[model samples]
Target: MTTVTLSGVGAAMPQPGDAPSSLEWLIYQSATAALVDAGLTRAELDGVVIAASDQVDGRAISSMLTSGPAGAYLNEEINVASSPAHALVTAYLQILSGTHERLLVSSWGKASETAGGSIQAAERLSVEPFYERDGGLSALAATALQASAHRAAAPDRARAEAAAAAVAARNHADGMTPADVLASPLVAWPLRALECPRETDAAFSIVVERSGRAGSEGISLDGAGWCTDSGRVAERDLVGLPHLARAAADAYERAGVRDAAAEVGDWQLHDYSPDAELLAYAPLGLCAPEEALELALAGAQPVNRGGGSLRGEAPFGGPLRKVVDAVSQLRAGAGVERAVAQIAGGFAGQFQTVLVIGRQA
Candidate 1:
């Protein structure tokens, strides 16, 4: 396997007190910012890989829709059409294959265009048409089942909720209390409205290079693993995702990790819903799900130091921002030597992807 380095990272979003911008503008902003961060001109990019969603972008061919915006205009572009993490891994593989030396990875989504229940309806339609669509399986309901399962399986349900609530309070952007999180109206039995991520429109761009070939200011992109499970959420055991566990194991092995629970410096798991972070603990080798929540609330883990997705998140760009934030932290010398950016797609995390990035060889 060949290692790669993230040479640059940049993003665009609506600043506080500023009005929202077009998706195209956001993409352009990030694309240009990424080139600046890499200290390279646009002429150096050999190709581009974009992650996008047709449903979220509200278009037929999302790749074609974003070509100009993402700065891939006349260049060879490969669209992952899945999670942004998938696009990042694809770029890594291309570098490893020696077919490409430098690539720009980008992804974006604008939830503001179709507000109200339009986005929700489109998401519900993503379910298996024959098996799940008619039954109306959407993001909220799928996550609600998972939350309910976690609540039922825990030894001390109140303590678990309290721990999750404490972590939730820490993620409220500004000042927020545990009582506030607990008081929020329930979205779907057991999952309060505040526990869910606040949707936002955003875009992210990254530059990657082949091993031993990047500038001195980059972070190493060492190991990655992606896998998909049954899309039928009702069929799988909600308590544990075996395939996600295997994906984590594969990522850890590739990263030469012996004990992830104690080794990793950053845990950027895609906590899509309330307590979702707790559920991911054991699967990603952090700890028993029961203990993970407690550890997280007690300040024992680095899970979502910047509030994860709960603070503010992009609909299709969740994975993209995770990678971008990790890069920013690594660059800031924030006591992080290694970081894992994880994302999920499909039903109940039917697809899981992991990227283990570090500062060393």
Candidate 2:
């Protein structure tokens, strides 16, 4: 097997109305920035892997419009309609197969162009039209169901909410308290507005190359795994996140990680909701589900040091951004020797993927 590493990463996360640039411009900006950071010309690239959504991009066959801006012109290109982390998984496999030496992976989301109600309607459509959709299940409602399950499983609801607030406060500039979080309007039955991620328009690009090919040492992508659970919401063990557990186990086994809590220095779990982050801790082997709230309150691990999605989340690009952040931290010698980035797709987090990256092979 050949080793693969991330050579460079770039991102464009402009707030709504903060920049006049179109989505294509943001894609081009990030792609060009990544190539520049890698010290490689676009002509040297082997191919490009893109992560995007036609519904979110507001165009049918959206990749056709995005491929050129992503430096894929006249080159092999493929798109993953799922999360951007899956795009990285595809790129990694391509490089490991020796079919490509160096590849550019890009992902973006322009939430600014879509209306909130429209997005929610799109999410509602993702449910099973036969039953779930008729029951009024949208993404927010599914997540609320999961949160309600977590709330029931929790030994102490007040303590769990406090811990959740503490996690959110870490990302807020003004800082927030448990009282503040509780006082916020409840978007879902059990989830407060502050506990949910704010959607943003953003793009991210990464340069991945086979080890020893780029003339520059980069952060190694040691292992990766992904899995999808049954689409039926009732069938899932909402509190366990079994699919995520399986994915993480596969990744850890491939990486020879026997004790993730001790060996992995940083963690970037998709925090679509604060409870979603907590739900991940046990699955990722960071802690027991019962102990997750306490672990979070204690700040015992280096989880979401970049603030996770609580700061700003780009639906398509968010997961890839976490990978970029992990690579940046490892490269900067930020006391992190290894990191794990996790992402999910589908309604109610039905799909899960995990990547273990390290400073050394």
Compose the digit string of candidate 1's lDDT tens values, residues 189-241.
Answer: 88898888877778999998885654634588878888888777878877787
Model 2 residue runs over 4 Å out of place are none
> How accurate locally is residue 210 in candidate 1, as Cα lDDT from 0 to 100?
80
lDDT of each: 0.80, 0.84
TM-score top scorer = 2
Q: Point out where model 1 deviates above 4 Å.
A: 213-217
Model 1 residue 352 CA deviation (Å) reads 0.9
Candidate 1 residue 351 Cα shift, in angstroms, is 1.4
Which candidate number has the best lDDT? Answer: 2
Q: Write model 2 residue lDDT over 1-361, tens digit each, in one string.
A: 5778888888988864574778899999899998888888899998999998887888989999999999998999999887787899999889888889999999998777785667777777777777667898877788888888887889998887777777766644255666787789999988888887777778999998998864546688889989988989888998899999999998999888999999999898877777888889999999877789988888667887767777777766666788888887788786789999898877778889999999974
Name the lDDT value of residue 319 in candidate 2. 66
Q: For residue 206, what is the lDDT in candidate 1?
A: 91
